[model samples]
Target: MTGAPLLRVRDLNVRIPTPGGELHAVRGVNFDLNPGEVLGLVGESGSGKSVTLRALLRLHRPPIVMSGEVEYGGQNLLKMSEARLRSVRGSQISMIFQEPMSALNPVLTVGEQIGENLREHTALRGRAAQDRAAELLDLTGIPSPRARLADYPHQFSGGMRQRAMIAIALASEPRLLLADEPTTALDVTIQDQILRLLLRLRDELGMGLILVTHDLGVVAQTCDRVAVMYGGRLVETAGVHELFRAPKHAYTLGLLQSLPGAGAQRQPLQPIPGGPPNLRALPPGCPFAPRCAHVTDECRAAEPPLREVAPGRLSACIHFDELPALRTELQEVHA
Candidate 1:
């Protein structure tokens, strides 16, 4: 499973329309997913983590433009026929959406939704499908799955709905799972349980997972690698341990500094100053320059491409060398 990449995305760009203008939601994002690998896409809201992953499944609707290579199984998914794309989705690659209630059909029962996936992708049908749905629910640690199959989405708690979503995503026994904040609305204990459940499922099924979330703690607990996203672009990427130990990009450092647990006792949380840039009108140069403490003339002059600063590590900052000093300062300030 680890010999070759299961999915490779290169130079991916996604644009969406708004009343104001076309917003560049994702800009030249690139990543490789190997079987059994858990990669965390860490970024604040609207940082394009979800948008970038959604492109792999062609989940966006019209007025949306996506370009570049999404190579899976020797084919470019971005260029595949819609019918072919549909065949791949769920069957080979499944998504556990952000919000369970919205992702699960409100009108459908939990069993029906899970059974639908089994019917569409697998050979299961009728009684077998119904029984499998209950088993799937059980697999996800849902209690009394047989009794709950008839329950609607609204009848379940946030955590239960998320588990149901995971069970449905697993129906096809997909090789890849794109989980978009599967634990977003769940409490801490439930979130931990869901994360563990996913890890267990991944090990059992040997599927690669791209977990899109803003939580560094979650990334630390669940991912093998972590990609840090900023204004529609990757600011840095590293092994999960390497990233948390020593981040290279300013944005990555800022995110760590903002973590309450990352600071000393009595240290105030040092939230990253300013807001993310508006995608519709991104800076002509580095998108994060406006909010960066180390911005320079060169930074505002042009955008920096994500380049390797070390083996197995990439950063998209013009002044990345200065980041260590700045990181220390921020740590001291928070301390």
Candidate 2:
């Protein structure tokens, strides 16, 4: 923990205009990312995890509306001018997308891509930029950096491309790195290598990281804190150990129990009962109530506000107090 958070998101909301009406993609989401900490944002597809990250970077297109404070280094990113945001984006914060093939330029060499940021953010040029680019490649564990500098992205393997992405992201030495499923396309072995590389970079650079993914296993291995989102809202947040040890929200417990290794042999994994609620026509109460086995009448009528159930543990379920009993029963049934 530091004196003040490096990034603070307060009461964030994002909506889009649809033919039916407006779709609420995110609702009153709030969190903080401290320096040198890894915050894991986990949820199913369409849970607004990607949208929230895009909104932070001001990447959403037209018809998509956003309201909230994204405070970074004393400046509200949401309120900054386009020019100011441009100054902040690469130099102060960098983002890595899941698909490197799409993110990288097909026409440019790997060195040219990494050097682009250095040229834009710094005064380095020609030989200096080339040297720095090679250095970044080396930093990211890309072998034979000098030899690879002249190679195009298509010449590299999937893991190498991701490593190049990391090199580009680190070229600016940003204070924060937003990685959206950075290892999605890689094989399992390569995925582990990438995860270890990311952890190494975080330790060596002391930069804050936001790893957004649907894989709880990734979160368990790489994150210090975890936030579970459902229906575009944060339903639970806790330290990684606390969350895995005794999850407080039904959704959180379900997610943990649903892991492939959570149950016995030949038994089907118990997925969360129902699909995520529709953002355009969400229910009045808890968005997860329909799928939650612990749901009650109150859960259907009134939305439960996120409240602190224990020190540094917060859940949005009304029956969070009874989660322990429910967890035990579910484990027994699945055991």
Candidate 3:
């Protein structure tokens, strides 16, 4: 993190028109990703993790308003023209979407899909593109990749489809990859395989990655840093081990408590009380104030700003200092 960041996001806000009103999907999100760093975005469903990731590439179409400075390599991606953005999309900053089954074209062969990317970004064409596609597939650990190139999306298993998605994303050798729940649809073993494969590829290519997932276990295993998002905002961020060992935010502590421990086989999981707030009409103060056990009268007066509470850690909580003692108390209760 000493060198200049590969990607810098500042004051990112996304709004989507909804029947209820304009849904504030992402709210003033900001983060920096250094080269070769893996930053995990962990949150419950509807927490805007995916939206924020997509905003990096300006992927959303009309009716969705995005305001932010997504600077990469000293260029503002948010202000880039559509044609310019298209050139940057798969070549510089690629994305592996949540579900490959839907993302992959049903009518096209895997090789054709891959060749399209190669044609768009790289100079490889026809037979050359096809050969490169096979190489990419083999790199992803798919057996007989050359033969699989002829297969359709339906012909591949769920795990293989996800691998194919990864292969397609890597066709252009992007410097930054945005993976949205890449392993969500696979079995436990396949999930592990995918995570390991992603890590290996990141190391091999020296690429920065942003992984979006609800699973804390995945973040713990793969990410260098973890950003916990809630109610369309980042609630806490820190180094992976530091955040796990001693969470600084009430919401983060609640999330850790909800995870099932290895020692407590029969112990009931302590679910976070209440649900995420309604983004359409978020509470005036801290969005998590209603569900936070550490909530104070001051917490409901105005939203707490996300700020550094310690070295390499950020938290949006007026009571962040009390969390360590509260964590110990939660452990005793679970014990």
Error of 1 at 107 (Å): 1.9
lDDT score, candidate 1: 0.88
Candidate whose lDDT is highest: 3
Which regions of candidate 2 are displaced past 4 Å?
A: 262-268, 325-335
In candidate 1, where is summed lDDT lowest over 10 consecutive residues?
326-335
For candidate 2, what is the lDDT? 0.89
Cα deviation in Å at residue 144, candidate 2?
1.7
Q: For model 1, which pairs clash?
A: none
Candidate 2 lDDT, 1-335, residue by residue in tens: 75999999999999999999899999999999999999999999999998899889888877788889999989889989999999989888999988999999999999999989999888899999999999999887889999999999999999999999999998888999999999896888888888898999999899999999998778877899999999999999999877877888999888877876543444467888779899998888988988899988999998999989999988998888787632323233222
Model 3 C-alpha lDDT per residue in residues 1-335, reported as the tens digit of each score: 68899999999999999988999999999999999999999999999999999999998888999998999988899998889888999999999999999999999999899999999999998888889999999999999999999999999999999999999999999999999999996898999899999999999999999999998888878899999999999989999878888898999998888887754354578899898889999998999999999899999999999999999899999998887632223233223
lDDT of each: 0.88, 0.89, 0.91
What's each prediction's TM-score? 0.94, 0.94, 0.96
lDDT of 1 by residue, 1-335 (tens): 34769999999999988889889999999889888999999899999999998988988888799999999999999999999998999999999999988889999999999998999999999999999999999999999999999999999999999999999999999999999999897889999999999999999998999999998778878899999999988889888777777788888988887776544444577888899999998887898888888888998999999999988999998877776632333233222
Segments in model 3 whose C-alpha atoms lie over 4 Å from true places = 264-266, 325-335
